[model samples]
Every structure is written in structure tokens, then in C-alpha cells.
Target: MALTTKVAAGFGGMALVLMAGSGIASAAPDDSVIVNSTCTYPQVIAALNAEDPVAANALESSPMANGFIQDLVNTPPSGRQAKIDKVRAYPAAAQFSGLIAQVANTCNNY
Candidate 1:
């Protein structure tokens, strides 16, 4: 083959490899959070809203979140609002809050 043809082929292969790697790197962090029997996204939202531990448990088997909901639900009405504000303000949990908010709005889950 001509040297030019070989050079072009080499660059094309490198580009394909780089692009595939970048795609893998850019993928959502939750991609590894297996969805084994996980509830449909909508069910997740509904369970969250209802704060039904049984329903939430079945939805995602996310004990921590469901447990939080249970505590929130059991809190006095006046205190629950503060708890919610704290939850939304949680730095690490903020991304999830934003995602849920976007989903809720787009899904017309209002």
C-alpha cells in the first residue's frame, strides 16, 4: 500500500479508539448501578412522593432512601419541611435531587 494510505489508516484506527474510550468515560456514573428488578423510573418517583416504605422498598430495594422517607414521613409536619430542605442541600445528594426534579417535571409527574 502507499505510505499515505497506511498513514491515513493508522490515524483512523487511533481516532476510533480515542472516541470509544471517551464515550466510555463520559457515560453516566449510574451505569454500573445495576437495575436488577428495579422499578420503572416513574414508580421510583411515585414511591418517593408517597413515602410508602413498602412501595419504595419494592420499587428500588433502596433501603437507605426508603428509610429516610420513613423518618421524614414520621417527622412532625413543621419539622418535615426542614428535613426536606436539608436533604436538598446535601452536597453529594444534590445531583440526584436535580435529576429527580428534571424527571418529575418532564414526566408531568406534578
Candidate 2:
């Protein structure tokens, strides 16, 4: 899958947790926090909206996003880190690394 697709999947999966209100503890604002299921939908969206409205909008409105989310949701929480780690390991991760960090940093405040 394309790197963007992978990211979309990751975010989509996270979105599910957000909607479910997983109530996970706030993680330190960093890329690693992207795998955390605790960050609420509002918190993540707000962070994304503040940092990159376009990406935030895409996340909210993208049709393929739901499929991506479903893919992530199917994975067990214990394995999410591996999935994220694999994505991060991709060279493409450098391009959106900052965006991920920004979301994590802002959302962790909630």
C-alpha cells in the first residue's frame, strides 16, 4: 500500500478509538503516541485542524478513510504498535512525521 494509504489507515483506525472514547491516558506528544487509542476524536481533530486543516479535513471527509480505519480496528491493541512501527519505518514517514508529532503534541494536552 502507498505510504499515504498507510497513514490514512493508521489515522482511520485511531479515529475509531476516538469515536469510541477509549479513555486512554494521554501519551507524551510524539510519533509513538499515534498508536495510542486514548486520544479522543475531538482532541485529535482539533489538533489536526489547528496544525493542518487540509489533512484534518481529509481525515474527516475521505471515503476511503473508513476502510483504512476498519483495517486498523481489526488489529488487536497489543499489535497496533507493530503496525505503526512498520509505517514509521517507511521512508515516507519523514514527509508526514511532523504532522503526526503536531497532532500528538496538541492532543496529549487533553
Candidate 3:
């Protein structure tokens, strides 16, 4: 993938992460703590672990992807979709969408 595509996908993932709250709310632990906390790398890891240990472990395994995720979470939520839409023309759009949902689900639960 081009660097542009990778960056856009990162943003899409972030947007999805932010938008992922609807499905798992009932089963999830209280994430109110997230509101006051900054989305630091360690904090993000903890959040993912709290909601999805497998995903968290996977994240912990990749330092570069972890940094990318840290950047994504730090991004303002309002601008994420536009970034996502820019990459919708790519053939990987469908996969990007799926990735967004998965990452968002992980992030949103916390």
C-alpha cells in the first residue's frame, strides 16, 4: 500500500474505534475512566486489554502498529471520517471498512 493509503486506513481505524461503542456496552466494564484519561500508548493498551485481551496482546506484539494506533487515538474524532472517505476509492475499501469496525470496537469499549 502507498503511504497515503496506510495513513488513511489508520484514520479510518481510529474513527471506527471511536464509533465502536454501541454493540459492547452492556457487557463491557465501565469505561468512564477513559474520559479523564489521555489516550497514551499504555492507556490504550489497558483499554484494549480490558475489553479484548487477544487484541490487546496482538497490539502489544507490534511496536510500529502500536505507535500508529497511538497517533490515531490522539486524533480528533471529528476529522476521522473525512480521512476514511478519501480512501474509499481504493480496492481495499471494503477491508478498510472491516478494519475500522474491528479497531473501533476495541477502542470504543473503553
Candidate 4:
């Protein structure tokens, strides 16, 4: 009986560990882009739009792809207009339409 109890306890402990691990995994966001933030770009965009539609529109309309903006972070743009125009062209590029816009935008800032 004592041996059976020990075995049952071991199984329960293992089950607890597994459950805890699953919980931790589930807590992670599937689409988070910020290094430590839970917010995805879509979520951040939504928040920005909510806070200021005009600013959000400007950001969306800006030619810089999201990715390019991120990419140019350290260097920024000496010629801002030119940079925007170039990045905006990415969406028109065949490989960068619709959902690709997100990646392009993300890379813009990379």
C-alpha cells in the first residue's frame, strides 16, 4: 500500500508539472513582435488609431514600410520623404501586397 501511495504521488507531481508548463506556454503570445511586450503590431496600430485617428492615418499612409522603419531606427532617414516613397513602393511590389504589407512594414523599421 505504501509503495502504491508513492507511485500515485509521483504521478500527481508529474501531472502538476505538465499542467504548469502548458499554462506557461499558453501565456505566450503567438504574434507578439515587441521584444518583451505582449502587444502585436496590429494591436499597437489599433491602440494608436484609437488614441489619434489622424496620427494613425499618417503612420499608415507614410511610405515607409513598417519593417523599414524598424530597420532604419538607428540610422533614421536623412531624406525622410525619399525613404517614405521607397518604402511605400514595397506594397506596390508584387511580392508585398495585403498580408505582406505587415512584413514589409515590420522590416521597414528593422
How many clashes show up per model? 0, 1, 2, 18
Q: After superposition, how far is residue 74 of candidate 2 from its true place, in Å?
A: 10
Question: lDDT of candidate 4 vs native?
Answer: 0.32
Give one digit per residue, the lDDT tens place, for model 1 in 1-110.
43333322321111121111222333223321111112344544463455433433332444445445445434544443334433433333432333333332333332
Sorting all predicted structures by TM-score, with the top scorer first, yields 2, 3, 1, 4
Candidate 3 per-residue lDDT over residues 1-110, each given as its tens digit: 75445534443333332232333422122222222234555555665567556545555565554655666556554443443333334443343334444434454344
How far does residue 41 in candidate 4 sit from its true spot (Å)? 1.2
Give the TM-score of each candidate.
0.33, 0.54, 0.41, 0.30
lDDT of each: 0.33, 0.53, 0.43, 0.32
On residues 1-110, what C-alpha lDDT tens digit does candidate 2 reach at each position?
Answer: 65456556546444222121123333323424555555555676777788888777666666565455445545555666544544433443345555766676677564
Q: After superposing candidate 4 on the true structure, give the runs of residues whose Cα lies further than 4 Å from its correct spot.
A: 1-35, 68-110
When superposed on Cα atoms, how far off is each prediction in RMSD? 19.8, 8.3, 8.9, 22.2
Provide the lowest-lDDT 10-residue window in model 2: 15-24
> Which candidate number maximizes TM-score?
2
Stretches of candidate 2 off by over 4 Å are 1-31, 66-77, 86-93
Candidate 4 residue 42 Cα shift, in angstroms, is: 0.8
Count of clashing pairs, candidate 4: 18
Name the weakest run of 10 consecutive residues (lDDT summed) in model 1. 11-20
Clashing pairs in 1: none
